[model samples]
Target: MRVLVIGGTGFIGQHLVACLVRAGHAVHVPTRRYQKGRNLLVFPTLTLFEADVHDDAVLERLLSETDAVVNLVGVLHSKPGRPYGIEFERAHVELPRRIAAACRKIGVRRLLHVSALGADAQGPSGYQRSKAAGEEAVRAEFSTYSEGALTIFRPSVVFGREDNFMNLFARLARWLPVIPLAGAGARLQPVYVRDVAAAMANALENSQTYGKTYTVAGVSQYTLAELARLAAKWSGRPRPVLPVPHFVGYAQALLFEFLPGRPLMSRDNLDSLKVDNVSDEAMAPELGVVPTPLESVAPSYLRGGKPDRGPVH
Candidate 1:
C-alpha cells in the first residue's frame, strides 16, 4: 500500500510513517522543505516530497499516486476570529475537506483523520469547533464519494517523548520555581503517542474500522495539577503546583498571547479546558492496541530518558 501522509514530517506523523514502513507499506510524505524531512529518509520504504499540500493541483497530484491518506496537519495556536481563526479554518477544516475531496476525485479509498478527543461543534474553543467541522466536512465528502472508507480517531491529550503535553510540564518544572497551574482541576486522559500511531497504522485497511469514529484514551485519568506534579517529581524538581483562580489564569493566558513565539497557553486553550478531556470509550481493544499507562512511559522521558535511538543514515 502506498500511503500519502499530508503532515507526515510532524512528531506523530513521523512515528506513523515509520510504523507503516516497518509493516511493509510504502509511505509518501509531503513537506514544504526537503531538508526539514531529510531525517525521514532513514526509513527505507518512506519517500519525501517537497510540496505545498494546500494547493489543489499539488493535492490532486499526490492523490493520484496514493492508495490511502492520513491527515495530521494541525495548528494549536491561532489568532482569534469568529467561528474559528483563519489559521484553524485553513489547517483543520479546509485541509481535511480538501483531502477528502481529492481522495474522492482520485478514487482513493482509505482516510484516517486524527482529531482531538473533546472536539465539539458547540464547544468553547475554536480548536474544538474547527476540528468538529473538519470531521463533518470529511464525512460529507466521503458520503458523496462511492468507493472508500473514513475512520476518525478522536484521542485525548497524547503524551510521549516528543509530545507537547507532558513535555510542557517537564520543561516548566525544569525552569520555573513555582508552577502556577491554570485549569488545575480540569480532567484529562492522556494516551501514549506510540499507541495512537499504532492504532492509525493498524486501521489503514482494517474493515472493522471503516466509517467508525473511535475515541482513543489512556488507561487512567488525571487532573491537570496532578499531572503537573507528577511531571515535576519525575523530572526531579518536585515544585509546588499552585492552583490559581480562573481570572488569574485568563490574565496569564492573555499576557502569553503577546509573547514572541506561540503563546504558552491561549485563552482558547483555557476555553478547551472548560470541558473534561476524558472518554469512557475503549479503542485499544477495537483497534487491537494495548493502551500504555502514563506511569510506565512518562518517567523515563521526563527524566533525561534512557538514551534515544539515533537516526539511521
Candidate 2:
C-alpha cells in the first residue's frame, strides 16, 4: 500500500512509519524541513516530501498517489478557548477535516486517525474537546466516502525510548532531589510506541477496523505518581514525589505556561488528567494485538537501551 503519513517526523509518527515500512508499504512523509525527518531517511521504502500539510493543494497532490492516509497530528498545549484554543482547532479539528475532504476528493479510502484516550466532546479540557471534534469531523466526512473506511485510535499516554512521557520524568528526577508533580493520582495505561505502530499497521490491512474506534492501552494501569517513581527508578535516580493539590497544580501549570518554548504542563493538560486514561482489555485484541505492558518495555528503554522485542502478556 502507498501510505501518506502526516506528522511522520514526530515521536509516534517515526515509529509508525518504521512499522509501515517494515510491512512493505511505500510510505511518504511530509515535513516542513527535510533535516527534521533525516532520521527516517534510512528506510528505503519511505520517502519524505518537503511541504506544508495544511495547504490544500499540497495535501491534494499527495493524496493523488496515496492509497491510505494516517493522521497523527496532535497538540498537547494550546492557548485557550471555549471548546478549544486556536492551535488545537487548527491541528486537531481543522486538519482532520481537510484531510478527510482531500482524501475523498482524491478517492483515497482508508484513514487511520490517532486521537487521545480521554477525548470527549464535553470533556473538561480544551485539548480533549478539540480531539473529540476532530473525530467527529473525520467520521462525518468519511461516512459519505463509500469506497473507503476511517479507523480512529484513542491511545493512552504512549511511552518508548524516544517518548517525552517517561523520559521527561527521568530527566527531571536526574536533576531534582524531590519531584513536585501535578495530577499525581491520575490513572494512565502507558502503551508502548511500537505497539501503537503495530496496531496502526494491522488496522491498515484489517477491514474490520474501519469505521471502528479502538482505545489503545497497555496491560497495566498506574497513577501519575507511580509512573514518575518508576521513571526515576529506571533512570537510577530515585526521588521522592510530592503530589501537589489541584489548586497548587493549576498554579504550577499556569507558571509553566509562561515559560519559554512549549510549557511542561498547561491548565488544559491538568484538566485532562481529571479523567482516567485506560482502555478495556478487548480494545487492542480487537485489532489482533496484545497491548504491551509498561513494565516490560519501560525498564529497557528508560535505562538507555532499546528492547529486543515487544512486550509479552
Candidate 3:
C-alpha cells in the first residue's frame, strides 16, 4: 500500500513511518521541516516531501499517488498571540476537510486520524474542541463511503524518548528539588508510543475499523502526583511532588505563555485535564488493541534510577 502521512516528521510520525516501512508499505511523509539531504536522513519506501500541507494543490498532488493518509498533526497548547486556528484548527480541522476532498477526487480508500482522548468538538478546551472539530469534519466528509473508511484513534498521554510529557517531568526531577503539579489528583492513562504506531497500522489494514473511535491508553491509570513520583523514582532523584492549586497553576501558565518561545503550560492544557485522560473499555477490544502497560516501556528509555516494582495502592 502507498501511504501518505501528513506531519510525518513529528514524534509519532517518525515512529509511524518506520512501522509502515517495516510492514512493506510505500510511505511518503509530507512535512515542512524535513527537507531532502539537509540534517534529515532518508529511508527506503519512506519519501519525505518538504512543503506546506495547507496548500490544496500540494496535498492533492501527494494524495494522487497514495492509497490512504494518516493525519498525525496536533498541538498541546498555543501561545497567546498564536491563535488555536494555526496550531489546532488548521491541521486538526481544515486539513482533514481538504484531505477528504482530495481523497474523494482521487478515489483514495482509507484515512486514520490521531485524536486526543479528551477531544470534544463542543468541549471547553480549545485544543480538545479543535480536535473534535477535526474528527467531525472527517466523519462528515467520509460518511458517504461504503467501506469502513475512517478510523479515529484517540490516545491518552503518549510517552516516548522524545515525548514532552514524561521526559519533561523527568528532566525537572533531575534538577528541581520539588516538582509543581497542576491538577495533581487528576488521573491519566498514558499509552506507549510504539503501541500507537501499531494501532495505526492495524486500522489501515483492517476494513472493520472504519467510522469507529478507539481510545488508546496505557494498561494502568496514574494520578499527577503518582506520575511525578514515578518520574523521580525512575530518574533516581526522588524530588518532592508538590501539588499546586488549579487556580495557581492557571496563573503560572498565563505567566509562562508570555515567554519568548513555547510556554511550559497553558490554560488550554489545564482545561484538558478536567476530563480524565483514560481509555474507555467499550472501544478498546473492538479495535483489537489492548493498552500497553506504561511500566513495560518506561524502563527502556526512562531508566535513570532504581526500579520501583509494586502496585500504586
Candidate 4:
C-alpha cells in the first residue's frame, strides 16, 4: 500500500511511519521543513516532501500515487472563540475536510483520521468541539463517494518515550521540587504510541474498520494526579502534587497562556479536562491488538532503560 501521511513528523507519526515501513508499505510524508523529519529519513520506504500540505495543489499531487491517506494533524492550543478558534478551525476542521476532498478528487478511497477521545459537539472546550466538527466534515464529505471509506480513531492521551504527556510530567518531576497540577481528579486512559500506530496501520488494511469510529484506549485508567505521581515515580523523582481548585487552575492556565511559545496549560485545556478521557467501548481488540498498559511501557523509557520501539505483533 502507498500511504500519504499528513502530520507524519511528530511523535506518533514517527512510530506510525516506522510500522507502515516495516510492513513494506511505501509511505509519503509531507512537511513544511525537511529538517524536522530527519529521524524519518532512516526509513527507506518513506519519502519526505517539503511542501505546505494545506495547499490544494500540493495535497492533490501527493494523493495522486497514494492508495490511502492518514490525517494526524491536530492542535493542542488555540486562541479562544465560539465554535472554535481560527487555528483549531484550520488544523482540526478545515484540514480534514481538505484531506477528504483531496482523497476523493484523486481517486483515493481509504482515510484513517486520528481524533481525540473526549471530542464532542456539545463539549466544553473549543478543541473538543473542533474535533467533533472535523469528524463530521470527514463523514459528510466521504458519504457521497461510494468508494470512499473513513475510519476515525479517537484515542485517549497517548504516552511513550517521545510523548509530550508522560515525558512532560516526568521532566517536571525531575526538575521541580513540588508539582502544582490542574484537573487532578480528571480521569484518562493513556494508550501507548505503538498501540495507536498499530491500530492505524491495521485499519488501513482491514476493510471492516471503514466507515467506523473506534475509541482506542489503554488497559487501565488513572486520574490526572495519579498519572503525575506515576510519572514522577517512573522518573525516580516522586514529588508531592498539590491539586488546586478549579478557579485556581483556570488562573494558572491563564498565566501560562501569556507565556512565550506554547503554554504549559490553557483555559481551553482545563475545559477539555472537564470530561474524563476513558472509553466505554474498547476498539484495540477489534483491530487485533491487546492494548498496552502504561505501567508496562512507561517504566522502560522513563526509568532510564532502552525505549521499547517494538511492533504491536
- lDDT-based ranking: 4, 1, 2, 3
TM-score of each: 0.97, 0.96, 0.90, 0.97
**Candidate 1: worst 10 consecutive residues by lDDT?**
304-313
**Whole-model Cα lDDT of every candidate shown, in order:** 0.89, 0.88, 0.77, 0.89
**How many residue pairs clash (N, CA or C atoms closer than 3 angstroms) in each of the candidate models, in the order given?**
0, 0, 0, 0
List model 4 lDDT by residue over 174-290, tens digit each.
889998888899999999888899888877889788789999999998999999998999899999898988899999889999989899888999999999989768765558788
TM-score of 2: 0.96
lDDT of 3 by residue, 173-247 (tens): 888899998888889988877778877876788867877888887778899789888877776677889999989
| Reference-based lDDT, residue 56, model 4 | 90
Question: What's the C-alpha lDDT at position 243 in model 1?
Answer: 96
Model 2: per-residue lDDT, tens digit, 1-313? 9999999999889888888888899999999999999988888989997999899998999999889999999989999998899999999999999999999999998999988898899999999999999999998998889987899999888888778899999999988999998889999989878788888888898977878998888888899999999999998889999999989999988999998999988999999999888776555555767777788878877887767332211
lDDT over C-alpha atoms for residue 102 of model 3: 77
- Residue-level lDDT of model 1, residues 145-175, one tens digit each, is 7787999989888887877887798889888
Which residue pairs does candidate 3 place in steric collision? none
Off by over 4 Å in 3: 35-42, 79-86, 146-148, 282-290, 304-313
Please identify model 4 stretches exceeding 4 Å from their true place. 309-313
